[model samples]
Target: MIFIIDSLNLREHEPLVKDMFRLRKRVFADRLGWDVRVSQGMERDRFDDLDPAHVISVDDEGRVVGCMRLLQTTGPHMLSDVFGAILDGEPPLRSATCWEATRFCVDTEVLTGGRASNSISYVTSEVMIGAFEFAMSAGVTDAVAVIDPVMDRVLKRSGNAPHGYLGTPKPMGKVTALAALMDCSEERVARIRAFSGIDHDVMQPHRVTA
Candidate 1:
């Protein structure tokens, strides 16, 4: 399927953003029992209001399948401001061009399976490309994602391998992040597209007889 990347400002995206948050609460707070503070039936935080944050994701027939949050570095991200305590009380971020990518999640029920499923797991391609486009247009050069180890594998395969950025994986205790910078190479961009296609090809089976 041809997945389009839609980036909307809060005023323009209130509805979709609302849906995204509801899905987040359903998955992160309600389903996974994360102790996220609730407000107006949506989970929110202080950082949510700051940094002219950008929301990028795949719109699958009006449902948000994959999503990621990008916070431009006007102020310190969790890595610089919050994660330090766990990472020896020191910030790992090294560039003002960095934008933090967070809340990267895929709707599990709609996710593909085995090889076919693995194919579409690259859904983040469009989202990342969209985010990267936004950054490049805004004259940005660096990016970061604070993520879990498993999720880190996805980033690594996508060519965002994080070895020369700022730090290495550590015993983060409760701390977590994909935590890597953006690499704007033609090959990297191509990989993002290739994988996104593998992840989001429109063709699907015509029947389900179960």
Candidate 2:
């Protein structure tokens, strides 16, 4: 299931958030060598301090398998503050209707399937679905993601190709970073669901407290 956790409820789901950070450390810093900050086995940065909404995918056993971070573009974001070079001198897209999606990663050691149940492909698609759905529900019309070439190909293969791109690709760390613009539309969500064979709603109900 997918869980949307933000600053308001981050303390309520500490374990899941911790696991998500550790998974990011393994993927971005340890494995991909993305020049990210890693300390005490957790990869984090200043953006995390801004309380961006984290879309997390948990398996049946309650393990955080996949995750992504979403932040409003009208404020501080990676593409605008950190990866402005990708904009090629063009001002970073800043709008209330648009959001920036970043820090996407999955646990490869745990999810080893191809496209089968609980596989990497399945989890990736699930995370994407959750992100887009959540953004669309929040009155967002578009989502800009700072993704690498591999992730770009994955997005295309998973039926979530970007509608357009801003500027040109630039080498970043061990991969080339590209700014991909995707619409948060029902059609795009449906295409992903069809490609991943997921028909039911992916959002998990938020816990209600007295």
Candidate 3:
């Protein structure tokens, strides 16, 4: 199952949020070797305090298996505040309808031996669907993601490729990162669901306010 959580209400979902942060620490800080802040084995930053909406995937045991963060572009986001170098001299994007999707990761440790561990598994697509649905619910029309080439290719191979790109690809820590823009629409959501064989609604009743 998936849950959409508002940062303000994160304490209400403590266990899920803790698992998500630990998963991020593994993916970003330990595995990916990004220069991010970590405390008590959890990776987090200032944006987290800004109350970005989070879309999370949980297993039958109620543990976080995958997660993604969404921040309104009009406010302070990674692309604008931290990863300006990825923009390659282009001005930062700030718009009410465009939100930034960051901290996207999955629990690779647990998904190493199943169909869910594949390149385009239900876990990945389900979170993508959840992100789009959550954004649309909040009146966002587009999403920009700062991703490495691996994730970029994953998006393309899964048939959810970005509709536009914002910056040139450049080295960021251990990986080369770029900014890609994807539309927040039902069409994209349908494509992801069809590819992942997920026929039911992935969105939970919980939602975040912008």
Candidate 4:
């Protein structure tokens, strides 16, 4: 299942959040070799302190397997603060209707099966659906994500391709990073749900407060 956790109720879900950070450390810092900060085996950055909503995918055993972070573009975000190079001199997109999605990572070690609910592909799709739906509920029309080439390709293959791009791809750590613009619409969500055969709702009952 998917859980939307933010600063409002982070203290109540401390263990789940810690596991998510550890999973990020294993994926970004350890596996992908991204130049991310890892202290005490947990990957984190300044944006994490900005009260961004975290979309987390948990297994039947209640272990966090996949996750992503969402921040309002009207405020400080990675594309505006950390990854300005990808903009190519163009100003970063800042608006209340456009949010930034980042820190997307899945625990591949535990989800090593096929495209079932317990597999990586299923969890990835679930997380994407959860993020988009959560954003849509908050009156957001668009979402900008700083993704790598591999993730871009994955998005395309999964029927969640970006509608546009901000700028050209730039070399970042072991991969190339680019800003992708995606619309939070029902059609897009339906396509993803059909592709993953996930017809049911992916989100939990809790709502995230801005």
Candidate 5:
């Protein structure tokens, strides 16, 4: 299942949050070899301090299997702060209805046994469903992500292709990154669900209590 976690209520879900960070470290640093900040085995950075919302996918045992970060476009975000080069000469997209999605990672070891193709596709679509659900609830119209060409193909092949793109692709780290935007609508979510055979709500009930 998936959990929609925001910074305001993160304290109650400390364990899950920690697992998300560790999972990120494994994917971004250990596996992808991206230049990211890692401390004490957790991959996090200043953007994490911005209190963005997160869509986290966990197994039945509550182990984090996938996760992504969402931040308002009007605020400090990866596209503006870290990936400005991907935007080319265009101004960074800024709109209340558009939110930036970043730090997308999945724990393949836990979710997929030996990089099984089916498992990879399912986990990818599952987390995307979580993203659209959260964006709709928050009144966001667009979900933008800075992703590599490989991820772009994965999204397209999974039936959740970006509705638009911000700028041309540029080399980032070991891969080429570009800004892709997906519409935040029920119709789009339904398409992905139909493709992945996930016909239920992806969001897990919030057990966090203030």
Candidate 6:
């Protein structure tokens, strides 16, 4: 499973990005009835656009299975405007060098049994871990992850402790709610890569240090 990591804003990647939104709607808005984002039909905003964001995940055969996004606050991000309510007193932007992790969704099409752990949930976990590594290699010092209970656990276990975590983890699918931050670390990056489930034999050595 050779996952692709692209800038996401590129024209060639449009379809992949679109599928990502569709999946988000299915999981968050349509199925769970988060309706809050139903009007958009697709859950996307400024942070998903003009912001410095990256889309890293896998497209098995043709369908999108695993997906996650990275946002650098050095520019602009959803934390500043979109879902400000979740932050309470916490600053939306952590630092000039800090970034935010957002819009993470994994497709349900993957087969049984996850990559690393015995639990199937590790499939999604592997993707997020990969995203963390990608963020670090991209030059992120600190990262704020908008998360809930499930994800907060993963983020805290991201190897290196990030710099932001405030309030409780409520439920908000793609509306950009709840946040946790961590400083980027090489160790974390490698751990995430190994967790990517790329079958160590094929994972490009340069792309993953672990």
Give the alpha-carbon lDDT of every model.
0.56, 0.88, 0.83, 0.89, 0.83, 0.56
Ranking by TM-score: 4, 2, 3, 5, 1, 6
Q: Score every model by TM-score.
A: 0.73, 0.95, 0.93, 0.95, 0.92, 0.71
Candidate 6 local lDDT, residue 208: 35
lDDT of 6: 0.56
The best candidate by lDDT is 4
lDDT of 2: 0.88
Q: What TM-score does candidate 3 reach? A: 0.93
What lDDT score is found at residue 44 in candidate 1?
65
lDDT of candidate model 1 versus the reference: 0.56
In model 2, residue pairs whose N, Cα or C atoms come closer than 3 Å (at least 3 residues apart or on different chains), thus clashing, are none
Query: Which regions of candidate 1 deviate over 4 angstroms?
Result: 1-8, 30-35, 92-94, 114-120, 163-178, 198-210
Winner on TM-score between 1 and 6 is 1
Better of 3 and 6 by TM-score: 3
Off by over 4 Å in 5: 113-118, 207-210
Comparing 2 and 6 by lDDT, which wins? 2
Summed backbone clashes in each candidate are: 11, 0, 0, 0, 0, 6
lDDT of 1 by residue, 109-134 (tens): 66674334333355555556655555
- How much is the lDDT of residue 24 in candidate 1? 67
* Model 2 segments more than 4 A misplaced: 207-210
lDDT by residue for model 3 (48-82), tens: 98988888998767778899998888888898878
lDDT of 5 by residue, 10-107 (tens): 88789999999999999888877788999999999999898888888887776788899989999888888778888886679889999999988777
